[model samples]
Each structure stands twice: as C-alpha cells, then as structure tokens.
Target: MSPNGSPDVQAITRLVEEVKKCVEALALPDRRAALSSLRSAISVLEDPEEAAFAQIFQSPIYNFAIRMGVELGIFRKLLERNGTPVSAADLAAECAAEELLLVRIMRVLTAIGYAGESGEREYVASQLSKAMVVPYLEAFAVHSSEHSARAAIRAPEYFKLHGYKTPVDSRNCPLQFALETDLHFFDWIHRHPEKAKRFNVCMTGNKLRRREWFEWYPVAECLLKPFERRNRNDSAFLVDMGGGKGRHLEALMKSFPSTESHLVLQDLPGTISSLENLSSGIRPMSHDIFSPQPVVGALAYYTHFVLHDFTDERCRVFLRAVASAMTPGYSRLLLNEAVIPERGCPPVFATGDITMMLVLAGIQRSKRHWVELVESAGLRVVDVWVSPDDGDMEGVIEAEVAS
Candidate 1:
C-alpha cells in the first residue's frame, strides 16, 4: 500500500472529483454520453476481476434484481411519488412483497446505483432508474429473463449435442433444443400472447428515437418525388419489409408531409390488423418478405434489423423475392442491418451476437459478408453509409438489382 492507503484508491478519489466537476459544469449531460464515460472510466480504474469476471459471474443476480424492480412496481411507485424517499415498509405494502425481503432486494438495487439510499431506511429512483422503467425496457428485461435466458442457459447443451458449426436454420436452433419444440421464433411467440407483446415492445424500442439507417441515409432524396413532378407521382417510393408497427413509415411521413410519393408498409396480417391510429400517409399491406414483393417497383426496399432473425438461406429467399420484383435500373435495396467490423465489436454487440447465435444462428455480418450476400441475390452494392461517431455499426448499405 502507498502512503494514502493504496494507489488505486487515490486514483479513484481523483477521478471521482474530476467527474464531479465535469458533471457539475454541464447543465444536462446526455444519458448515453454519461454512461459511456462512466463505463470507460470504470474499466480502467476498477479491479479487473470485479469489473470483468466477477460481474459476469454475478450478472444474473443483477439482471433479476432489475427484473424484480420492474415486476414489483417499485420503480413505478417511486416515480409516481416523484423521487420522494419511501420506507421499505411502504414499498412492501405497495408491491405485496415482504418488507424484510424487500429490504434485502433494495440493498442489491442501491448497490447497483439503480436506487439511491436517501435516508437510513428509505430509497428513491435515480435518473437511470427512471429511464429503465420504460415499457420497452420492462418487456426486454422479462424477455431476457424468461424467454431468451431459457435458450441462452441451454446454449452449451446445444453446442455439446450439435457441435460449434453454425449457419443453421433458426427453427432448428438452440431455442428448439431448449424448449423441446421445433417451432420458429415467430410461431413460438404467436402461441404466447403476453410474450408476443413483450417481443413487440422490444421491436418498438428499436424504432423509438434510436439510431436508424435514415439518420445517415438520404431519405428525402431517395423517396421524395422531384419537386417538378410532385403532382404526377404514381408508384410507391419505399416498402419497409417486415417493418413492425409502421413506426418508421409514420415518422418519415411526418418529416415529408408535403411530398406526394406513396409510402408503403408491409408485414404479416396480424401486424397490420393490430396497428392503431395508423397514419393515412402510408399504404399498409399484408405481405411476407419471403413471398414475392406485392408492392412492386419501389424506389427503395428497406429492411432494418430483420434479416438477422433468419438463417443465410432464408435471407436469400427474402432477397431473391425482392430482386425478382424490383425494376432492374430503377429500384434500390437499403439494408439497415449491422455490418460488424473485422477487428473487434463492442461488448453489447458481442453479447447480442452470441444470444442471437443461440436462438437464431444470426450473425452481424462483416462488409465482405454483406457484399457476397447481396451479389448472391442478384444485387450489386451502390454505397455503404457508415458513421462510427454515431455508432451505426457500419451503417446502411445501398444496393441495386444486378444487370
């Protein structure tokens, strides 16, 4: 130990003071920015075991603790009271969990910085905690804990039985092995309505103020009719294949309300039927991507975070369908899926890839993979729009039908 207890301790003290100053100076730091800085700082300052291995080992405990907070309405209660400190007894009464047990759980919550210990026996939600209570997050946590975790926990068993060679079909993957059923991921979700809602929420989260292809892509330039011919627009400009909830189309309609080009949204019949207060701006159609493109000759066929749910062969089926219907010289295909870097991926993407591997044999493909896949489907790459600063994961890939 150095003179001041320990060098690491002193370093932490200095870092904490510096962080305090930085945060204090800012009127309001972005949530993601704050999280990024905190995570980077912790990685360097904290013990490797505690930061890495220990946390990995104890991750389930933390995940479940967060789940319990969501399920028990603890965060809702605290938020309702507007961050006012409340005793364990009051929370216990509100949630129906025993006070003593709640106290133990609250200790875990506070330890994780989700809940702040306002007084000796009271608690309040932190800003991060409030953000975590979104319906999207609740659904995600439950999905990970109950549905995804079941398959994830049994990933080793699947590996042991089937070997590590992947590129397998999603229907016959680890999820099937874990559940002892051969249904596809969507079919399984259909059987469980509640879990389907959760799945929907998670998908909705993707379209809700999150990073998307349109952020860097020229949406207006591609979709909008040239101002000179505004009165004579005929065909659909874009079709969002398997686009859930029609959120993307609706958002775009708002952005280009004056443009006369038709916007189309295509998905399953059930998805189309469930959409509420759907904007009149988008032409809704019940069509599967695997089937022939029903809305033909679209200037752009957009697919975001959709292709990863299937095997390579299934992706080929979807792409071939689009290629067959697209006008050779006019139509363009825009892929918003991840083109994972060759070097290394962020931990979140790594974990996501592994989880997808367990359930769907899904891959975040590299640029070469994207090129090969598109060419195999009779399409040629036009441009790949990437923005590393905004974490676009190799961004959007624009392609056109092969001549």
Candidate 2:
C-alpha cells in the first residue's frame, strides 16, 4: 500500500492533474471523463468502512436533517440573512425549534457542505441551502422522503416476497406494499390534494434541469410544417397527453408562438380544474390516459416524462389508445424520456430504474427497449433526437404508426 493507504495513489494523482488541465482548457467532455474516473478512483481509495458508513448510514442522517430543516423553515431563514451567519440560538428561536436539536441538524448540514459553518455555533446557507427555498425543490425533498424513500426501504423485502421478478403490476407494487394501499400511484396522489399539488410542483423542477424537447427536435419541420397543410377537420395540432399543469404545452406555445393550430393539455379532472392562467391557445381537457384518445387525428401526441410511471403491459395498452387516434401517415407520437444505455449505464439512471421499480412499477428503457416497446404498441420509431450537450439525460423519441 502507498503512504496514504491507497493502492494506486500515483494513478489517482495523475487523474487529478488531468482533470485540472481539462478544466483550464474548458474541455467539458474531457473534464467529465476525468471527473467520472476520479470518482471511481476515490471510491476504491476510500476506507471501506468509512465508505460503507457514508453510503448506507450517513446519507439518511443528512436527508432527515435537511427535511427537518425544511419543515422548520431554517433554510428560508438562512437565505433571508444574505450570507450572514446566524447563531444557533437565534436560528432556533426564529424557527421555533429547540436550540440543541437545531444545532445537531445544522452540524449534519454543515458536515455535508450544504450549509457553511462560520464561527462556533453559527451557520450560513450555502447555494444549495438557498436553492432549497424554491417551492418545487422543497416539494421534491418532501415527496422523495415521504414516498420514494419508504418504498426503497421495502424494495428488498418486496423482491424477496415476489420471487425477485421485475415488478410490473401498477396497483400491487413496492410503493403500495410500503404504504399499504391498493390505489395506483397516481390515484393515491390525486386523492391527497396537497400531496398531488406538491407532486406536480416536483415535476416542474425536472424541466428546469434540462433543455425542453422542442429545442433540439425538428419542431418546425415535423410539427409546424405539417400543421399548415393538415386536414382542417383535424383541428388539434398537438395533444400533451397526461400533461400535468400544462407546462410543456405552455412551453410549446412560447417556442412556436406564430402557430395558430390547436394545443390541448389532457390530464385527470382534478389536475385540469386546478390549472390557472394557461395560455388561451392551449385548451385544457380532462381525459383518463387509459381511455380512448378524445382528440383524434392531431398532428402530434406528446407525452413528456410520463411513460416510465407504468409497466410494459400497461404502456402497451396506453400506447395502443394513442396509436388508435393517430392519422397513420401524419400523426407523430413524441416520447420525451430517458434512454438508458445498454452498457456502462450511469449510476443515476441505474438508480432511477430501481426507484421506478420501487415506486411506480415502471422502468427506464434502453434504446433497444424503446424500439421494442414502441413497436409493440403498433408504432415505428422514426428518430430519437438528443441534445449535443454532453449532460443531457433525456431525449425525444419520434414514432408513428407502422405501415
């Protein structure tokens, strides 16, 4: 072993130097590769016991602390200070939490670099902590802790009980097993108004992280060009199927403001009724996803980050419903989703696959899987458009009715 107890410190040091050079040259791809290598190197170099504690035990402690901090409005209070550190006593008094408990939570946050430790018994919010004040981010934390985390804990038990088979039953999956409910995940959320609203807000957070689909896809040629020549009776230009709060539709309107063709946003009745200030060009329609498509022969039917919430069997049924409505030669089915790589898949996606299995009985599909899944629904993959940006995790899969 080397002086630092790492078997390969020399290689790791070279990697660090390479990463620095890439950073100086502004070589994003090289930098990303170096960073990934560095992470792997560090994992190997780290003390196994420490790594185990950090991975299995330390994360939950920090998560619980952050959740409690959000509940007590500590992050917001820290943000209001504008980088000025506040004493534990002052923060506790303001947030109405016990001083000792608040300090313990702050210690965990500070240890994780989420909050800055300035002087003894004083703290300041980091950028991450400031970001936590956003409603969507806050909601994401709450939703994950309350729902996904619980399901994840039960996933092992669920697998053992179910003979380690992939979960495809929407109503009897890990989320239901953990929460002890029979309702489908969406139905369960809808039944709780506040939780439903938070879930919608959490979804909006995803949009902020990545480029909108229209940005990279051939929207003008594929959608607008066809809209001008389409059958007049087919007034619906685009349908945002299962679109929560119509954010994507609103985005499409902004992206192609000149188009006067119909834009419809479909969702559950509760979701549709709660929508406010939707662009007048976008029509909000209440429609069950599993039901037949009500707006027929639309230029395109778009589902954004929605499909992974279901199983292959359920998706086949849902896609068939959309396919039945397509005007074979003209209508395109746009699926904006992640396409997991067949080999060397990133940990984020691998984790997402498990999370989907646990909570939604769904999956993150590979390119092969996407083709198979789409074709299984009587649709043919036309193109998969992904951004040239290296970190873009999602893409648009353009499909149409098979000949």
Which parts of model 1 are misplaced by more than 4 Å?
1-12, 23-41, 220-232, 258-261, 387-389
Q: What is the C-alpha lDDT of each candidate?
A: 0.78, 0.86
Clashing pairs in 2: none
**How many steric clashes between backbone atoms does each model show?**
0, 0
Give candidate 2's error at residue 181 in angstroms. Answer: 1.9
Give lDDT tens digits, candidate 2, residues 19-100: 6666777656666676687788788778999998899988888789888878999889998999898999999999998999
- Which ten residues in a row are the worst by lDDT in model 1? 223-232
The most accurate candidate by lDDT is 2
